[model samples]
Target: MASPVLLCVGLSHREVPIAVREQVAVSADDLPEKLRRLKAIPGVREAFLVSTCNRLEIFSVADSRTVADDLLREVGPAGAPHAVVRSDDDALTHLFRVAASLDSMVVGEAQILGQIKDAHETAKLHGAAGAYFARLMAKAQSAAKRVRTETQIARGAVSVASVAVQLARKVLGNLAGRTVLLVGAGEMAQLAARELHQSSASELLVANRSSARAEEIAREVAGVAVNLAELPALLERADVVLCSTGAREPVVTHEMMVRALKARRYRPAFLIDLALPRNVEPSVNELENVYVYDMDDLERVAAGNRELREQEVARAEEIVREELAALRKADRERSAVPVLARLREHAHGVAKSEVERTLAQLAALDEKQKKAVQAMASAIVNKLLHGPTSRLREEQGGPLAEAAAELFGLAEGPGADPVANPVANPPEGEAADVLPISGRK
Candidate 1:
């Protein structure tokens, strides 16, 4: 049977606008159903979906390369126009890069790896991922770990949250005594809260629809949890407001910010909107002394950070390439296994049959003499088979194995098994290990 092809199809921040991305974005509650639909496609053997704020991709192991077309269709018309497809090695490479955060808008950001792992676990839970995806996920995680450990790509303000904090500092001059309000308890909000805390912000207030989640995040940053109902009061007190809620409408309206600004006596208020569909209204930026930065603004700052880490980014890419090469080499060696097994089995059968016939003809010989003859025959068979066996292994069971099968008249097909019809009184000692083609030391 032909090997399954690796395929990746999706749209990312590089190709799709945030508005279109928002339209195609899959919520946590909807991911399982989406994955189920993808897995049901004809020729799709295994599949998983990765949906983040910046990208939505489907990774699959399928029987046909054209499965990309089906995957694009699954993405729907809005995303299909902006989608890109990668197959085989290119697909594998893209997955590794994503896990390593090399393909992120903020390259070398630390969140993509965890996001990918979560997506993979969700796929496996819903029966969408199989053996192929399990193995691929493991390799991608290993590559990400290596990049983090061996390179400096993750150093400094690499994440969008951290970059947003940096921008806040540049605008307000200092975060040291600033009261920062986090308007959500999501991963991005928690990250931004941590960044602000590390910058020595005097107080951190977490406001969320879920008080328990807000309290959880607040405790981690040595802050307080406030009720979302009191957002206007929290906004008035906060010098910097970071919002990353999942709400469809703008959570912080222009009117709310205007009132907060009047309450603060027109002091500069820095707002970072890290959510898709945007938590803060765009009109809020029109207000004087109020600076609002959204995902695109954060990305521009992140681009400068990427420029600063060009060397480390290059190193991370090298690690990804190394992992990809190693996986391909292992796969090649595994492909050669069946051919080598057949070659050894064929040779052992011929050696054993001839030895048995010769021994039967010399019936006058004693048991010890017969045993000695058997050992000699076995040793000769081992010596004769050694060169061919080594050559097959060296060639990773490629063309040499096929040629050897042809020469020895061995059966060749998906179901071919030379050992099914065993040779009676098989060769002993050194030749014993040689009988099983995979047993070579």
Candidate 2:
């Protein structure tokens, strides 16, 4: 038997550029298949994967460092500088941090927490999550809720949509009484609409391929709705345009912008492209007075907000540390379970073996008397093992457990039967940087 080891490996916005992040991100539709494949890998006991615009992370339990290496190879390009690995305690801590949104590009964004939940649930649905991940994910979710409840980590505009609105304000000044255009009516577009509305964007205009969806969002914001075919015209009238559509190709091409810019006499328009495949053509960014910003640009804005939330971030970190310690303590207690179970089995086996031997000599006794003798033998074994069992549970990672194993002749050495010494040894050569699970019993 091999002791389970937790491992994580992948890249995030913290280390990789958006282009690279985009290249490796697995779509939500593709996640279940990826998770099943991960569980199929040799040495992996369980697996869960989180893939978002800002990060791509794989969380798993396996038998050795090879599992981490294997997972990295599965998800990341060879020698990818953006990808990194952590194991055991460090991996556990990382999971908590990610769940709590402390490791997010926006530090305290609420979306990452939901994204983590989605990933965990997907893994569970596919039968990839096991006992280890069940507890870990529960704790991570609890930690995230606690951070939001106890601190201001999630306060203010902590989303990409809000950040984009803030950037628009930075370029075009207060959105008060300004005309704002929303291009998709999707979640991000809706969020941007609300943010701009709160900023007193005087007029809201919605344009989408589906006139009904566009009208729905436009009505909600008390704005005018139009067909996406009218975007070239709307672009001329609006001051800021936020786009998040499902189009496979650019919705706003360079020629379209050139025409829109010429129509507005190049009156300086701010454009935000939130779609993954990008709603606006990249080349449109080169047009004069046609400012185009995408997910990466909003990240820069979020970074500034992160600086203001440094105190909240610090407070959040303290909470994670406290929770992590409690988690590890419980983990340490669990490590003793197998050791205690084996000890109990070995003791009972001896008692049974001896009881049978004594029964042959007790043929002179009545059946009732022989039953009493057998009960007494079992009781004595229980009493004899009770003290050691308590110590084994109480003093995990201490010498007493190993000492008791030796005393009972259960410890494995040269010529010892592997079947008899079923307790697994701690993994070796686990890099200090990788961080092994501590306090193995």
Candidate 3:
């Protein structure tokens, strides 16, 4: 679809805040609806969206270079700062890195591969992804698989939940006899529950606004379900708090925690706020004997995890670069394909017409004579095409190529313009950082 150019416009953990990222994130349940809207946008011939909590990425192909802005505009993430837009080769490279998990905040995480696959499948199911994206996604997945298979990129603390649990152990020394309170029942909270169970935390308490939802997660982790109203009491007794609620505002504020601490006589509590907008208040960290860890705090642990996996990262990068080079070379080589096909088709057509005419005029000829004439005609066609075919292919996208097409009338054929540039940068956007580089070429 479109120019066969790959374009990716996205805001990631690199620059965008959690607040803005959440606004554009498309979840698994919301993917199909979002994909339909993305396809309906003008200038976008093919499209798919990958919106994880950490990022909101739009991948598309279009005729004009300005499509990136149109894409972001269509997605309604306008005025969001630090969006990176790439086209063709760079865009593909970015995708490859993302699939390989090299672009993740926690560089060797394994969950991103599954997420990317889900996006690819969603696009295909909705008919938004065509031959180009299909092939590209497949190749990207293959490379990611290879990276994981050949390197140790996914060795430690692969998910945010796991990292949060690991850090809790460091602060508490041992989780075996500790009471771990989970303030929400989201995926992250469930994962934390599982981690706590594995760490042999003595008592686990799950508190949610919906008692049924809390009960469900509690059953899964063999923990007890407590009502949301019991949060203050649970907070007083709990040694560790993992909060991951979907609430828009802070659930555990400074004022609330101050009351909880008074009940505990100011005993130390370790808190991990995994919610995007943050469930725990930032000011709560100032409380004596209370330690607060947000996503950004967990990020520091992820940075350390990345450091430990540096060797694996290097290997993964090399593999990604290798795959990228092959893709680029293949793209460049395909430019000559259309012209060669047109040349062959034209020659075959002429040879068939002449052979039919000759056979009709020489009706007196025997069966053997007709066969012999057919063989000669085939040979003539082959000989006639050999020289010009070789020359035109070698002169792809130049004056000589244009001249050859005009001389042979192959210019009228659908495949004549075989070597058009797949990417172009439009000058409509003044923000060079956010605009696609295709327009610059």
Candidate 4:
């Protein structure tokens, strides 16, 4: 029988919009049921689903190539139009790239590795994954680790929220005892608040027009919720200001910052304006100790970091290729195992049968003599088979194993007659000529 194919079928950011991706996306709570359903599909021997913000992929070991069609059908209506399919080596290579984060929306982001691990574990827990996925995941993780450690691909911040944090650190030295003022409770502001929270900021003040929204974000980041009316007071105390409000005009005006800067005795303050309409005034940057960064500035930093990461991608890809070659070689050697076992069993059986026949004819001999003859036959068989077995293993045993079975008249599996043909159990007078040690055909 042909070995099962490794198949990957999915819709990623490259092929579809977020709307289409969301339609097929599986949540963590729903993964078990999704995996169970996939395992039930015909020809799908083993499988796992990787669902994230950017992609929804199904990896499977399948009996037939048509399993790709089945997987697409299962991913809902969006799958057939946008899904890309890869089989065998290409599929495995794609998996390795995904685990290494090379295929992420923001390349070199580390989240995809953990996401893949979680998906694999979920599949295994639900019995949707078997030996094939276990090995594939292990190799993929190893390759990802190598790519991370051996290259500089994951060295910098690629997201706007993270870049804001980096810029804050660059200007403020360290956030250890610094207070951060979050000027909005919108999604962008919330993300910035979370990033600053993780940086060990001493205090985070959340200010928003809606008191309830401000309090909600404040509670999430372990901070105090201040009224938007207290912006001037909050600015004076804050070392960093992150503004992402929905106001039409500048919330942090030049005059407001000037008064706040004087009250604070001109201490350096880093301001990040993430709002689309510019929450902070452009002229506020003219203040000697005040640094203002708008969305354009953050995007520039992110773009620069992305370029640096792109430069490291070639090296990361080299590591992945090395790992892939090693895995393929290991798989080939593993495939030789059963064939080698069957070949040795057939040889040992032939040797034992011949020894038993000779011993019965020499019944006059002592027990010790009969035992020694049997030992001699076993020793000869081992010595004669050793060279062929060694060569078969070196050559990965595929074609050579089939040839060995045919040459020795040996069956493919156990419980078959060892001497099933004339070549192996030659008729009486022909026995001497069969497999002669001397070159006398």
Candidate lDDT (C-alpha), each: 0.81, 0.77, 0.76, 0.77
Worst 10 residues of 3 by lDDT: 423-432
Superposition TM-score, candidate 4 onto the true structure: 0.64
Off by over 4 Å in 1: 346-386, 398-441
* lDDT score for residue 288 of model 4: 93
The superposed Cα distance between candidate 3 and the true structure at residue 356, in angstroms, equals: 8.1
Which residue pairs in model 3 clash with each other? 424-438, 424-439, 425-438, 425-439, 426-439
Q: Tally clashes: model 4.
A: 0
Candidate structures ordered by lDDT, highest first:
1, 2, 4, 3
Each model's TM-score?
0.82, 0.83, 0.81, 0.64
Per-prediction backbone clash count: 0, 0, 5, 0
Question: How high is the lDDT of residue 72 in model 4?
Answer: 75
Residue range 103-204, candidate 2, lDDT tens digits: 887778888888888898899999998666777888888888899899997889788877888778878897787888999855676788778877888988
Q: Which parts of model 2 have CA positions greater than 4 angstroms off?
A: 76-81, 219-223, 362-383, 396-441
The TM-score leader among the candidates is 2
Residues 101-193, model 1: lDDT tens digits: 999989988899999999999999999997778877898899999999999989887888888888888888878999999988668867887
State the lDDT of candidate 4 residue by residue for 73-156, as single tens digits.
Answer: 877885556777776667788899999988776567777898899999989989998766787789899999998898888876
lDDT of 2 at 205: 89
Model 2 / residue 249 / CA error / Å: 3.4
